[model samples]
Target: MTMSVTPKKAIRVVVWGENRHEQINEVVRGIYPDGMHATIAGGITELLGDDVTVTTRVLDDPEHGMTEELLAETDVLLWWGHTAHEEVTDEVVDRIQKHVLEGMGIIVLHSGHHSKIFRRLMGTTCSLRWRNDGSDRELVWTVSPRHPIAEGVPQPLIIPGQEMYGELFDIPDPDELIFISSFTGGEVFRSGITYRRGYGKVFYFSPGDEVYPVYHHPGVQRVIANGVKWAYSERERESYLVTPMYLPGGFDRPVLGSPDGLVDYYTRELIEPRENAG
Candidate 1:
């Protein structure tokens, strides 16, 4: 189903960046003087226009700028991180995970495959063979042309220079494969893919490296913008599996009394209380 956010109710997007590279590296600063998060958010705003309300957040912000209130209002979130994935606290990861399971969308970019949130969602190491040659060419080919994320993207999006990310990427099989990329060295990788965890949507695009001007590429920008739109959920927010949920669409049923047992939430079978209960 096509998810469209009207002008009256724009899709709320948050672009989260590590912001460490631009702060400490001159080369990275020259490419993204205002920080990569700003550039990414700007690209989405430029493409989606009023359809999306974009905001920028960074690792240095309090709670990584991902307060509960902020996440509650956000419909889709784009994540870009490297060098300081460990610095993102476990508490924040838990919050992000909970929100995602509750229906907020997320896009994990570039090296974010190794991030705690991604790894937790993927249930894998999220490892891959990589090289910082700085001159490797990347050809991003659309594998699933009919997918929404590939709407306006060309058959082959050519990137002149990029860090090589080879295959054998340690990740669970994605629900949908959107794009695959090949490096100059003949190594191919599943670059763009999507997954649904609980009520949330996820997209992982591997093209924007800090060392290169990949984010400035028009095609890459379009892909990210498209991803934001595609990731948004159209339905009203609904809580995930939790306690107090009754069976048969919350329908009430007869409760048969047992000597020392009660019906299970799922199996509807009688279970006895444990003797070692506190």
Candidate 2:
């Protein structure tokens, strides 16, 4: 029963950042001189090496550096936005949503929970209790130790300083809960969770804060890299899922129809009828 499978090409990743903090705040600039997106991309490249091609994008870039052409080529997109979440146009959010549903994987990091793309997909407020006065220690516990995203990650990944994100996390329950984080203030949050939207996979990891050097932590970087890999979809890219009809006794080829035609298109039962069925 052993079947040989063809290997896929290297995973293509794009790290999208707000880039506002590094530009305006000296402390953030000092921590991540090249912007957090670059750091995140660098970590993915460092970990995945030849297995992945990583690129950095920012909100300030034209079309927020998420052009249709670029997204078409991207296999997995890592988003990190904070102050400029509202600044992201609805058009871009719609574009991202379309791609995500079409099988492009997305990894939302930290404050990205509030981003339009995340909210649109989640259909909720995506809110949570948080503290940003620094001085918060986070212990990310691997709730799902056997999960692929938790592979090689420490049992209790310790982040010395980070912003607290506590529960009352206003979103649907995750398909998979990988990591749960406990902060110094005796609050716990579902730090790492995954969801499936159409043909795409979504992972949200809350850790990296602009003020703290959380991204610099090796464990944190490893988790993010692992999340990127796990989020990547192996299916052939499609514009969107479609219901293609098949003729009676014909299963291999679909009965394709023109987009302009409505009456010609038919919806058939997805499951073939059993010959023994009355």
Q: Model-by-model lDDT, in order?
A: 0.89, 0.90
Off by over 4 Å in 2: 1-8, 246-254, 259-278
Q: Which residue pairs in model 1 clash with each other?
A: none
Instruction: Report the error of model 1 at residue 165, Å.
Output: 0.7
**Model 2, C-alpha of 1: deviation from truth (Å):** 26
lDDT score of residue 179 within candidate 1: 95
Q: Tell how far residue 83 is off in model 2, in angstroms.
A: 0.4
Residue 272 lDDT in candidate 1 = 39
